[model samples]
Target: MRKGADTMQRASDSRTKTIVVVTIGVLILLPAAYGFIEKLTLFILAVKRDLIAGFTIIPVVNYLIVTAGMACLLIWAVAHGMFRRIEQPKYTMLEREEEIDRLDASENRTGEDR
Candidate 1:
C-alpha cells in the first residue's frame, strides 16, 4: 500500500512537472514565434504587390483567424479540464447489460470464458 501510494504520488508530481514545462514552452515560445512570423509576413507584404490588398483590405479574415484560434483554445481548455477531472481509474468495467447490448450471440462469440 505504501509503495502504491509512493508511486502514485511520484506520478502526480511527474504529470504536474510535465504540464508546467509544456505550458511555459507553449505560452512563451508560441507568441514569440507568432510575432516573429507576423512581422516577417508584414515585411513580405511590404515587398510584394499582391499582399498590398490581401488581408489588409479584408478585416474579417483576420477576425476569422482570431475566432478560429479562440475556438480551438476553448476546446483544448475544456478537454484538458475534463481529462484532469477524470484522471483516476485507469481501467473501466463494462456491465454485462451494456456489453451484451453490443454483442450478437450467433454472429459473434462473447469471447469471455464463463
Candidate 2:
C-alpha cells in the first residue's frame, strides 16, 4: 500500500511537470512558427511588394525589416491570446492581493502581525 501511494505521487508529479513544460514550449514556439509561416506566405504571394509599390525597395532596406517585424508582432499577439485563453494564467493582481490578505490575516490570528 505504501509503495502504491508513493508510485501514485511520483506519477502525479511527473504529469504536472510534463504539463508545465509543454505549455511553456507551446507558448514560445507557437508565435515563432506562426511568424515564419506568415512571412513565407507573404514572400510566396509577391503581392506585398506590388501593394507597397517600390517603397520597400529603398537605399536603407526599410520595408524588409518593417514587414517582418509587423508579421512577428501580429503572430505573437495572436498566439498570446490563444495561449491565455487555454492556459488561464493565474497571476492576476486581484488574486495576488487576495493571497496577501489571507497571509496577513493568518499571521494576525497567530499574533505574528506585531
Candidate 3:
C-alpha cells in the first residue's frame, strides 16, 4: 500500500512538472512567434513598396531592443541568484512561516498563563 501511494505521488509530481514546463515553453514561444509574424508582414509590405525603406528597419531595431532587454534581465537574474536552487525559496518561505508561528504560539502561551 505504501509503495503504491509513493508511485502515485511520483506520477503526480512528474505530471505537474511537465505541465509547468509546457506552460513556460508556450509563454516564451508566444512572443517570438508573434514577432516573427510581424516581421514577415513588414517584409512583405516593404517588398511591395507599401512601406518606406526606412520603415523596414523598424523590425530589426525592435528585435535588437527586445533581445538586449532579455539579455539584461537574464544577467540580472543570474547575478541575483534567481536561478540558483529554485526550490530553495519555496522551502525557505515555509520554514520562515513555521518559525514565526512557533514564536507567536510561545508568546501567546506565556501571556495567557501569566
Candidate 4:
C-alpha cells in the first residue's frame, strides 16, 4: 500500500538522520575527548610520581566528572526524544494560546447574550 510505503520511507529517513547526527557528534567529540583524556592521564601520572602537586589533580578530576555528567544528560535527553522536535514546543504553545483566546471570546459573546 502507498501508506505502508510512506511509513517505511519515513522510518528510513529517521534512521538516516539519526546516523548522520551520531556520526557528526562523534566526529566533533572524539578528538576532543581523546586529547582531554591524554592530558588527564599525564596530569595523573605527574601527581603519582610527585612531579606535580597532588592538588593539581583535583581540578582535572572535577572537570572530567562534570563533563561525563553532562554527556550522560545529553544521551538521556536524546534517548528520551527530547531533541526530536526542538521547535515543536513553540508552535504548540502558540496553538494553545490561540485556542484559549478563541474560547475566551466565545465565552464573552455568550455572557453578553445572557
lDDT of 1 by residue, 4-108 (tens): 999999999989988998899799989998997797678556647674555564564676688789979978987788546353443344455556666666335
* Candidate 2 wrong stretches, greater than 4 Å: 47-114
Which should have the higher lDDT, number 2 or number 3? 3
Per-residue C-alpha lDDT of model 2 across residues 1-114, encoded as one tens digit per residue: 999999999999989987999999899999999997897577646646476644444633566678779979989987787544343455576688899999998988889645
Identify the runs in model 1 with alpha carbons over 4 angstroms from their true place: 49-114
Estimate the overall C-alpha local distance difference test score of candidate 3. 0.87
Error of 2 at 47 (Å): 7.9
Question: lDDT tens digits, residues 1-114, model 4?
Answer: 999999999999999998999999899999998997898788778888895488776787788799889989999997999977899999999999999999999999999999
lDDT per residue for candidate 3 within 52-109, as digits (tens), equals: 5756577877987998899899999979988766899899999999999999999999
TM-score of each: 0.41, 0.39, 0.48, 0.72
Best by lDDT: 4
- Displacement of residue 104 (Cα, Å) in model 3 is 1.2
Output candidate 2 Cα RMSD: 9.5
Task: Report how far residue 57 has shifted in candidate 3, in Å.
Answer: 2.5
In angstroms, the error of model 4 at 50 is: 4.4
